[model samples]
Target: MISFSQVTKRYPGAGGGYEALKSATLDIQPGEMVFITGHSGAGKSTLLKLMAAIERPTSGTVLVNHQNVSTLRASALPFVRRNFGLMFQDHKLLYDRSVYQNVVLPLNIIGYNAAEAGKRVRAALDKVGLLAKEKAMPVTLSGGEQQRLAIARAIVHRPSILLADEPTANLDAAYALELGELLRSFNQVGVTVVIATHDEQLQSRLQPRCIALAQGRVTQ
Candidate 1:
C-alpha cells in the first residue's frame, strides 16, 4: 500500500545540509507487518515520518495507496492521513482529556456523530482491553494503560495502515511486550503495521520483516 522510490531527505545545516535518508527505496504491501530498526540518527524515524507525510523527502517519490504524496496539494493532506493510523513515541494523549475523549478525538475531527463516535471509541478501547478505564484521565493511568490508550486512539478511526515510531520507548519490558503483542494482533486482522525502534528485545521477540538502516541508508 506504500512505496518509496529512490527517496532522499535532507535538512539544512550550518555547513551545508544533512541527509536523513539516502536513495532509500522500499515497498510495504497491505496486511503486511514490518519493523524499521536502527540506531539513533539512523533514519528509521525519518522513514516513518516520510510515509505519514509528517516530513517530505528532498528528492524522489513517496506513494501511498497509489497516490504520490510528494505531489499532493496542502489541502489534500487530511485525506491522506485519514487513510492511515499513526502512533508516536510519546503517546501524545491529552492530559486534560479522559481516555474515552482522547480516543474519540479523531472521529470528532472527521465529523462523526456523537453516537458513532461512542461506538468506535468503545470498540477501540475494547481492542486495547481498556474499556473500563475509558472515563479515567490519561494522567491517572499507569504507563502501560496510557500506552494502550494511545493505541486505542490511533486505531479508533480504523485506518488501513498503522505507522508507529518507537512505540515502547519509555515503557518497561513487560509493557513493551504487551504493546508489541497488541500490534501483532492488529496486523493479524489485516491492518498494515510498520514500527520503527532501536529496541533489540522487541526486534528479537516479534521478528517481523525488518528493514535495517545505517547512516541514513538502507543496509538490509
Candidate 2:
C-alpha cells in the first residue's frame, strides 16, 4: 500500500528551488490498479519517485508497505525497494545481454542462487509472453517485446507493488493497448500496479482508479 500526507518534493535551483510535488496526498490500497495522469511537468514522475524512494520529499510523509519512506535509512532502503518493481519509460535493457539475463539481473543483485533464479526468470518471462525469446538479444525484439521484457525483469524479483512511469511513451497505439493489458494481467493476480502515463486513450478505455495532477498538485 502507498500513502502520502501533504508530501512535497523540491529540487534546489540556483535561485531557490522548484517544487515538483506540492503537498500531494493520496492512498493506494494493496492489490489496487491505479493510473496517474498529468501533462508534462505535472509531477507524475516525481510522485512515483517518491513512492519508490528514489527521491526524498522535502516535507510531509510518504508511506509504502507500512514503512515511512521519508525516514527510511539508506541501509534499509534496498529491503524496502525489494517490495517494489519499477518499470522505467526507457526499457534500460543491455543490448549485449540475453532476455533471460536481463530478467535475472535483479535476482542476481540480491544473491539469489542460479537454479532458483532461473525458474523465477522463466515464470516471469512466461507471464509476459517472452518465454520463447529468452535467448534473444534485446535489440532484435520489437518495441512491444522489449517493453514486455522490461516488465519481466521488474517482476522477476516478485515485487508486491509495480510502478510504471510513462511506460507507453513512444509505442504505437496497438502496442500501448497490449502493454496496458499485460500490466492489468499482473494486477489481476494481486500485484498492485500504479502506472503514470499521459495516454488518454488508454486511460479512457481501462478507466481504472485515476489520480490526475496539475502543476504538482492532485486535481482529481
Candidate 3:
C-alpha cells in the first residue's frame, strides 16, 4: 500500500542544511500493522510526514496506493491525505468542543451531510469507548480517554490507512497496552495501521512488523 524508494528529507539551515531523513526506503502493505520505533530526532515522524505529503521527499519517490505523492501538486495534497488518518502526539483536540463535536470535524471538512455526520460521530465514539461522553468537554477526560478520542477523530472519516506518531507517549503501561489492542482491532478489519513510538512494551504486545530508525536512517 505504501513504498518509499531511496527517499531523503533535508531542512534548510544557516550553515547549509540538516538532513532529517536519510535515504530511507521501506514498504508497508495494505491490511498490515506496523511500528516505527526509534530514539528522539531519529526521523520517525519525518518518515510518516513524507508518506502523508506534509513534507516532500528531497529525492526519490514515495508511493501510496500507487500514487507518487512526492510529485503531487499543492492542490492535490488534500485528495491524497484523505486516504490516511493521522493521530499525532498532541491529539490536537479542541478544548472548547465537546467529544462528539471533535470527532465530526473531519466529516464536516469533507462536507458530509449533518444527518450522516451525526451517525458517524456517535459510532466513532462508541468504537473508542467514549459513547456516553459525547457531550462532555475534552478537558474533563483522562489521558487515555483523550488519546482514544483522538483515535475516534482520526478514523471518523473512514480512512483506509491510519498513521499515529507517539500515540502512547504520555500514558502509563497498561493504558498503552489497551491503546495498542484498540489499534490492532482496527487493523483486524483491514485498515493499514502504522505507528511511530519509543514504546517497546506496547510494540511487543502487538508483535507487528517493526521498522527501526537511527539518526534519520532505517537501521532495520
* lDDT leader: 3
lDDT of 3 by residue, 1-220 (tens): 9999999899999787999889999999999998999999999999999988788898989998999988788899888898988998899999999999999999998999999999999999999999999999999999999999999999999999999999999999889888988999999999999999989898778899999999999999
Q: Candidate 2, residue 190: CA error in Å?
A: 0.8
Q: Arrange candidates by lDDT, descending.
A: 3, 2, 1
What is each predicted model's overall lDDT from 0 to 1? 0.91, 0.92, 0.93
- Candidate 1: residue 58 lDDT (0-100): 94
What is the alpha-carbon RMSD of candidate 1 to the true structure?
1.1
The residue-level lDDT of candidate 2 at 137 comes to: 94
TM-score to native of every candidate shown: 0.96, 0.96, 0.97
Give the least accurate 10-residue stretch of model 1, judged by summed lDDT: 77-86
**Candidate 1 lDDT, 52-96, residue by residue in tens:** 888888999999999898999988878888887889888888999
Error of 3 at 87 (Å): 0.6
